[model samples]
Target: MSGTGTATGTPTGNESNLESAMQLMIQTFHKYSGNEGDKYTLSRGELKEMLTQELGNYLGNPQDKDAVDKVMGDLDANNDGEVDFTEFIILVGALTVACNDFFQEYHNDDKNDKKGK
Candidate 1:
């Protein structure tokens, strides 16, 4: 990468960049999932399954049973056992931040490696 804030040779705040990247991911998920209807939603099981399958190594098996249960408990709003758009957005926002932090660490490690070389 060129740099953190100016990676593309343009100034951008970390939060703004993060939001933009997340919006793209959200739009892509909506399109790929065919969530065209206003009432479209995903149940806890479906959400966890999708996260595990799509996110793969990022999610890392949910740590344990309690972790999985806690996540479902938090995201399943309305007591309907499903996550709506709002819940989905919140869930994805947290996940995106986690993924971004991982990438930042990897980038820093790579930079250190280059310097060592």
Candidate 2:
């Protein structure tokens, strides 16, 4: 990695991949949060849009609004009807953990299969 922190500089223009991902997380939240009421938080519509556009593959298309509503209800945390950065981070952390668990399990299963052959 270069001293300027450009291991492979992304459009986010940060230090490393981890740094870039962190920056992207902040950037993404602000991108959607600013579209509506608080500007520092995400209204339901903004949340739905963010999830649909940013997490469509992981969260699914959310063909019914119920999923969005449920997510909003879960992430609101303070009953404010909006998702703040902290609440959003919780969601991201949770999803990350889930993905990690899945990948680890998949890898283990694959390894076991290989051993069986």
Candidate 3:
């Protein structure tokens, strides 16, 4: 643990992997959040761009036509119509959990396949 940026929330380039990932998440959020009013949050267009660009692997090529709207609706917990940092974190956390579950299941399935063979 580099213990870097413990107070400032800025990455010191010497952080642990987990710390680096956290910084990346914050950086990614700010990147798109600045495109509209309330620089601390994501507008619908910014959210769409971020999803289409950053989450393409999981969200799909063009993604479901309704993915942006649906995701925005779900993530806007306060019904503010824009996703704030906390809401964004919730989305990321949920996706991470889902991905972890999926990979764990996949790994288990592969192990079972080898046993069957």
lDDT: which candidate is best? 3
Q: Comparing 1 and 2 by TM-score, which wins?
A: 2
lDDT, candidate 3, at 13: 75
TM-score of 2: 0.87
Between prediction 2 and prediction 3, the one with superior TM-score is 3
TM-score: model 3 vs. ground truth: 0.89
Give lDDT tens digits, candidate 2, residues 20-109.
Answer: 677689889999999879999999999999999898888876555999998999888899999999999999999899999999999999
Query: 4-90, model 3: which lDDT tens digit per residue?
Result: 666535777778888888888988999999999999999989998899889888767525658888999999999998999999999
What digit string (tens of lDDT, one per residue) describes model 1 on residues 1-117?
322354333334444665666555555455434433333666545565556656657767864666667777888777776667677778777988988998999999999999999
lDDT of 1: 0.64
Between prediction 1 and prediction 3, the one with superior lDDT is 3
lDDT order of candidates, top first: 3, 2, 1
Backbone clashes in model 3, listed as residue pairs: none
TM-score of every prediction relative to native? 0.55, 0.87, 0.89
Q: What's the lDDT of the predicted structure labeled candidate 3? A: 0.87
